[model samples]
Target: MASTDNALKTASVLAFERKLDPSDGLFHAGNWDGRDDTTAWKPVTLREKSVRGTISNRLKTKDQDPAKLDAAIENPNLQTVDVATLPADADTLRVGFTLRILGGTGRPSACNNAAYQTKLLSTVQGYVDANGFGELGRRYAHNLANARFLWRNRIGAEQVEVRIQHLEKGQPKTSWTFDALQLSLRDFQTPNGVEKDINSLADVITTGLAGKGHVLLQVTAFARIGAGQEVYPSQELILDKATSKKSKTLYDVQGIAGIHSQKLGNALRTIDTWHSEADTLGPIAVEPYGSVTTLGKACRKPTDKLDFYNLLDGWLLKDKAPPPDQQHFVMAILVRGGVFGEAGKD
Candidate 1:
């Protein structure tokens, strides 16, 4: 029989997701692409078009005027494409990623058993580091792991969060297994650099956007099945939400409709409704290549009592539903006049 706790088995599966499109491509995105001519690093920029591709054509100066020779020689240097100078509309791109751990060969452990688990995690890190993951970049150790042991590196575009947990309850005498492993990159760092934490990655995104006034997201998903059929990718999703909540809130409070709190409030309310309905009416089949359509309230503020007009307080994850608490889950809060956007709203 499947225990009530059987669902928790899947909890151990970690899923990480992020958006991976920077408004520009020529500059730094998330992690370094290891492609720069100056430092064995060439920035990973999504190339939509190119004027030249062949070396034979590149050296074809046969019909040039002598006066134009110097200019043409310099033309190769001038042939560079400046992604930074691209139009603002170019920021519209996003990506998605997913990683999962099917059951391990051995038994598993409890989530609270931090001591022994740490050592086991280190062993895994050493394995990954010794055996590089190619373009997936290097593995990094996380907090629960020995803070330095290292897990694999990945990039995601948007519309997701990273989750990790134990595959089961009792301490396993031999081994442990994970169910899901996924990450969502908030910005395009490098398609191949390591980010130790979600916070650090988020910081990179917020900083880049603040300076460039735009951002892009790219997502990649690695799926492994059987022996060979194990890699696939998805189209990018662009985040068009211009202007930070901070800037918009300021103008909004000042009667500037563009930055109005009412709009923010409305957005939150919408999120709340949509989320609530999905939870109640779902087993929403949110699978790959499947439409992720849902109707729910936006991010909202919960009230003292159950007020229909007020914002929703939180959400309920089928996996994280409480035990004896009997209370509804609270997702996020909307401050009456709280900090809307300093950074990391997600």
Candidate 2:
């Protein structure tokens, strides 16, 4: 039997503020008002038309099976032709967003392990301070240059150019140019050959939507097999208008098993932190003016709950390193559901 510890799980909360087309339920970047300044970075929603076209082209070319091709084209969820294609303009879809390392519960952000979290933060900061978000930009560049975002990236994409806006306040905007055809043939490899550069496309899309005021994207990753050493995003749900029953047009794509689209009213409730249950750990909870040695079952305040970092610190103090599965679990709970920033909310 597979151990529960090995199960892959992840929790993420991506909030965005942007304008949406009431008629088509499409995202519009130019209409962003920038009302919320809560997070350090914001995401610009890319046109669904572009996303659809890109996906469709890739699918048709790569999959030789006629039935699968038809399914890809006919399925409303997978079909990109329904939306009108717009000309690329000044409002290009920029790829970049600030990824928070701490979850609402002070756990590792995105359910990443302590080691991964430490490396990501330190590496990103080092690059940002020295060269100004260049490493991130390169990753974005590699994605666009290789058309790795396409649903069928292995096949290749036609001429494509992606413009990445700098996350830093004063840095200049830059464009990463690449020929999809050339990138397809190039045998690019990361320092560690275990993972490919193109694999980051999923991360790029999930993070890019952080600022799109309309949609709330929550991703969860957990071990599905073995000792749960490797975690992968098992669920990526989109809370949008198409899935809402109140809307006149229902864009339900049942074939795409896990993509959830719900009305804004229902979606907001998923991440509502105001009325969340307190998740606590440790033998005795810390309380104000409480006796620590008393047997009256000490409890820690919700705000005082230990996050992933703190939990890791506690584990380190014991001279015992957390196993991979435990690390993933700790991080998952931190982001499971609840507002991290609000005091006593989780």
Candidate 3:
């Protein structure tokens, strides 16, 4: 696979001390009076804890691997792995992992689940807890000794390898296990310069597409990549008879077609109108109309046009906003909404 300039490879280690049962591995919320010797405070204890594992990547690859380089070439799909991890609250903890192709290199088409390394080394999280009656104090322990990664290769050969060893004291040398393992890749841009590493990009498109000015796209989102650039939908379009045979109505459609209401459409339009007005008005000082207030106290109170822009800019840009001017960028987008201006002060 041809790697992207932003591919990153890293490992995360998490540790949770063991907890006692009955509380089911959670610390109770109520506060007790330590001064009241008359009352007994059910001594809350920690017996077991868990760590989540993740691996992310953003590598590019060509449609066909070079025959000469196939042996040594490691594609993003080849490195993505998924393993189960134990949950602290439940008797059985399960962890899920997946690999994704952020972009493509030589190949015009994108990559999927087939290219990852077949060998995955994962172990169930387990530990022993003993206090000798709580006076000497209890201990939740597990050693990392002999932890291994196991997976199969494309040729169907089973591969098992050790990654950590000796996790706990006074336990069987082979008793250590892991809950889950994940791998992801992405580019890392820094202030000193662009330092691209293999790290997994967030599934921001699916998770945050419902908000204003954002649309879910399949091809175009992957196509735009350059220095100091942002990801955005090429355009927004509604389905019509020529496009979708269902002939669903919009803004006031029926049944499944009408899942979104006219009230919402009008609200969206109002938001759009405000943004458009802001471009010329500079800023607004009026209370917002429609459902803007429903966002609750978490919404920023814009005192100027820039304030309004700053508020919605994060939502406009799916990924993290660039620093220094990020706030300025945010204010600028909101300013387009025509909702606020420089004269407004609240």
Candidate 4:
């Protein structure tokens, strides 16, 4: 139990407005430069195939015919298709969102909670001044530049392209293409090595944070699910309603896959929640007499309550606060987790 006196009482949410249109784009990977190509947005279709099994003692016990089994085996069996390519005319998804510090500069009322405001305000402002929302920018850039927004990216997606149109004073419309599988977290670094695209994205975010403009980002994703030699789990594995056994159909076995626009919208919501690394401190339990520690070593007693700002303050004091990117990532997640409002009070 952690003490409530030092708890975090306020936070800001970085919500984005989003839209998905599956039918808008030519569905293919190779036509990225606005060229007409046949490979773009190709639909994946699955054809049913027969299953072959060998006759055995179990079949004999069931009075199954071995001759029929042999005949079935002799016929040409359909090859298994584990993944599918998405067809053109598939709905293309579009997400519209902005990133900004909710309570900074012109939005003092954003952090209206009286208890923690005085203490945390200066720190937050200092962070804004130095980092210019770099952490939030970096994460957003990574999500787009890496195609982390593509649900099928976990499978095999050749390309994930993001076309950005910024409505700002000095910036022009820009677009970037990324190899979905090749983008990594390290690409968001300040110097960012040879990846000029990521660096440009970082600059865009910095401009947004500086109040120069808002970003309009449209993402187009193209993926091939079941084409290669690898076998993947079919989408049709379900419990049989009649037999209550695991069942599948040939339709489930093979085909191309495309993500729905609504699903793409939902994926973007993931940024709202924070995911922190596991706590290094061992667990602490409180008993009627005293405290028990997971390590079985001498330790301080547990507090009654705990929250993000408290931990952040402690870390800042100890010079152990995470880097700006990590901090922004955690904050976004915390906002999505609903850890703000009066309930966040210490």
RMSD of each: 22.6, 19.7, 30.0, 11.4
- Winner by TM-score between candidate 4 and candidate 2: 4
What TM-score, computed on C-alpha atoms, does each candidate reach? 0.19, 0.25, 0.16, 0.47
> What lDDT tens digits, residue by residue, belong to model 2 across residues 231-329?
111123336858643312212223211112223211111111111122222111111211134355323232543333343433433334354333433
| Candidate 4 residue lDDT tens string, 45-153 | 4444444544333323256588886675566533332343333434232222332322222223345555455545455556566766555555556655555545434
Flag regions of model 4 displaced more than 4 Å. 1-112, 158-172, 185-194, 224-309, 312-339, 342-346
Expressed as tens digits, the lDDT of each residue in 23-77 for candidate 3 is: 0111111111221232322221222223333324332446646663453344222
Candidate 2 lDDT at 88 equals: 34
- Residue-wise lDDT of candidate 1 within 203-253, one digit each (tens)? 333333223223222312111221211111111233453532211111111
Query: What stretches of model 3 exceed 4 Å from their correct place?
Result: 1-254, 257-292, 302-306, 309-346
lDDT score for residue 62 of model 3: 62
Q: TM-score: which is higher, 1 or 4?
A: 4
Q: Predicted candidate 4: what Cα RMSD to the true structure?
A: 11.4
For each predicted model, how many residue pairs clash, with residues at least 3 apart or on different chains? Answer: 70, 18, 82, 35
lDDT of each: 0.23, 0.28, 0.20, 0.41
TM-score of 4: 0.47
